[model samples]
Target: MKWSEFKIHTTNEAIEPVSNILHEAGASGVVIEDRNDLDKDWSTMYGTIYELDPENYPEEGVYIKAYLPVNSFLGETVEEIKQAINNLETFDIDIGHNKVTISEINEEEWATAWKKYYKPVKISDKITITPTWEDYQPVSSDEIIIELDPGMAFGTGTHPTTVLSLQALERYIQTGDSVMDVGSGSGVLSIGAILLGAADVQAFDLDEVAVKSTTINVKLNKVQDRVTTRQNDLLKDIDVQADVIVSNILAEIIVKTTQEAYQLIKPGGYFITSGIINAKKELVKQDLEKQGFNIVETNQMEDWISIIAQKPE
Candidate 1:
């Protein structure tokens, strides 16, 4: 089989939303090449190894690459992806150059080439994300290991937004508390919640692939019985209330669902949200506050932001 690789050049602020747009356009996975990553001090024993090729990286901004099978509708899919990316500017997101390129490759290369980019990453104080193909050992007695194989899915549980969300989960999850995971990609948060002693988790995603990926990942961590997966738009018509509600999606979606999230969480429960770029933090913060949630914590890593808010009892 043949596959088309679409490489999009855009600003750092546009990477997350553009990648999401590509995913929604039927791309299984995406590769991000941020020029800033080349400047990071990565030799400080961060417990994560990244093997990046300088040739493929952008000279400015970032490059996001995704693969789609060579089919009759391939051209239409690519055009739609471009249009969706252009729509980001309406949200005041800087898209930079927004240059797009395409190339064809064999399916075999697509299957194995991406593995080299993933490694054992210690994302937070107690949680470490390891790919299924890697041989990893627990370096600490209390360390929590999340084993995941994104397969054709987009998340590997190591993105800054994901890391911040997991770290927040670590700090707030209580033993036997119920968790509601909105946009639970790869089921990483649900698995993390269960590991952190949450009694049960209801995970939802609008994407069918994400729902399936979450189900498989929950079972991979041996928490299928504790975590339930389903396809649902964020917090619409959901009657079940949870001890804690978490979402790691775009700031636009997060803000739109803030009120519903507030209604779905138990009194005094917490709402943790990420996938917010640095510039949009204040907007989301104000939205959550307007919905009667008291902002408790704000976390930032790189260009991303995460907020933890509590519903007043």
Candidate 2:
């Protein structure tokens, strides 16, 4: 399968609007990369995705992204994609060199394509998640099935940090506990709680794509009635206290969010947080400790850590 990869370089402020324009013009999807720029806003550098057409497609886009089609199912060629970027130079957006690799696969090797990447994943042994396109068996002990088409948005549970959070959720969630999943990308953590025995789950994230993606996953898992989503800044103006709180945002945000997260969890409740890098872990741990949370456990995976701290009993 031949595919075109497009890379665009421009000022931080223009990324979203330009990505939006490209989506409107027609794009299969966009992958936003965090290219280091001192002048760049870290907030804006987080990337997103969109869909484009292969049939009767407009090979050119005003805010062009490279496009190449894979022969596996459907998608465009690298050359056709390059032309689109070459055309966008007038807007002063520089196209990066292609590092995309394409390969041809046997047309009927459907299982092989995904099988190489898909493995039996237990969000917990009871709450096993399998991609919808893959084949898997749910043993009698398995509680629910979550279907997802994984992408860059987050919460596929492939990451150890997310897995850490899920394992903690499985351990702590009571049968009727209410949970608030802050930064609920793909709603994976919150939905996992609900499936694990939480009575009701409310989740929020800063990204619209995350909110939409989480909502979709909630529905896909048939837990829509149990899980609700909203878009809001971290615990600002939210007054209801829950039995458990989960946040998987950056360590800085997590550190700053302690006061608010503390307020959102009832005295007996606990908070689960990830997205903490090793370098910043102590800083956040100190901040969380000061908020009167007793650090119950810390689990490390790769360079990431998941911390669970309980508000005083």
Candidate 3:
């Protein structure tokens, strides 16, 4: 089968939303090529090698690439993706050049070529995300391994936004705590929550595709019995209190759920929010505070920020 490589050249700030657009447009796997990664001081603590080629990355902005099968509706799908990306600007997200290009490739090539971009990496002290195809052994007795298939989800669970969320979960999640994962794309966070000692998790996503992806990934990690995947708008008309509520989505959407999150969290519970750019960090902080949450911690990885707040007991 033939596939079209749909590539978008945009700013670092737009990577989350733009990659989301591509996923919503039915692109199963997305590849991000950020020039800044070339200079990043990746940790070799676990012997996770990153063999990136300079030629594959952009000089300035990042490149978000995905593969879509060649079909009659391909043109319309691409246009919808472009429109959705442009719509992100209304949320104050910078779309940068937003230049798009397309190329044709064989299925055999894409099936394995993209795998090189992903490998076992320790995002946090306790959590290490490895693609399903890789054979990785725990470097420590307490090391947590999360197996993910990027082709089956929106993200590979290695993005900075996700890493921050998982790290926050690692820090705040108590043993046998109940966790509610909003915007649970790829079910990575939900799975991570369970691995981090959460008794059970209620994973919700507005996108049916995301829900399906979450369900698949949850089972892949052998945590299906502990994670429940649901298709629902962000915390709307849902009233299940949890020990922790974690969401890694756009700051705009994160703010919208602040009230619901506050009400749904148990007293002294925690709320963790990520997928926020540096500029919008303060916006989320203020909103959470307005909803009566006490700011506990704020962390940043690269250009993304994660804010953790606790409800007064």
Per-candidate clashes come to: 0, 13, 0
Q: In lDDT terms, how accurate is model 3?
A: 0.91
Candidate 3 lDDT by residue in tens digits, 51-118: 98999998898999999999999999999998999998898889999999999999997787678889
lDDT of each: 0.88, 0.64, 0.91
Q: What TM-score goes with each of the models?
A: 0.94, 0.66, 0.97
1-313 per-residue lDDT for model 1 (tens digits): 9999899999877876787787778887877777877777776635645866789788898988888899999999988888999989998889999999999999988887567777898888899999888889999899999999877455678777898999999999999999999988789999999999999999999888788889888888899999989899988889989999999988888998999998989999999999999878999999999999999999988889999999999
| Higher-ranked by TM-score: 1 or 3 | 3
In the range 196-309, model 2's lDDT, one tens digit per residue, is: 899999898776766877888888778999998998887888989999999876676788789998988988899999877676778888999999899999888655688999
lDDT of candidate 2? 0.64
Deviating ranges (above 4 Å) for candidate 1: 43-45
- Answer with 2 or 3, whichever has the higher TM-score: 3
RMSD of 2: 11.4
The candidate that wins on TM-score is 3
Model 3's TM-score against the true structure? 0.97
Query: What does candidate 1 score on TM?
Result: 0.94
Q: Which candidate has the top score in lDDT?
A: 3
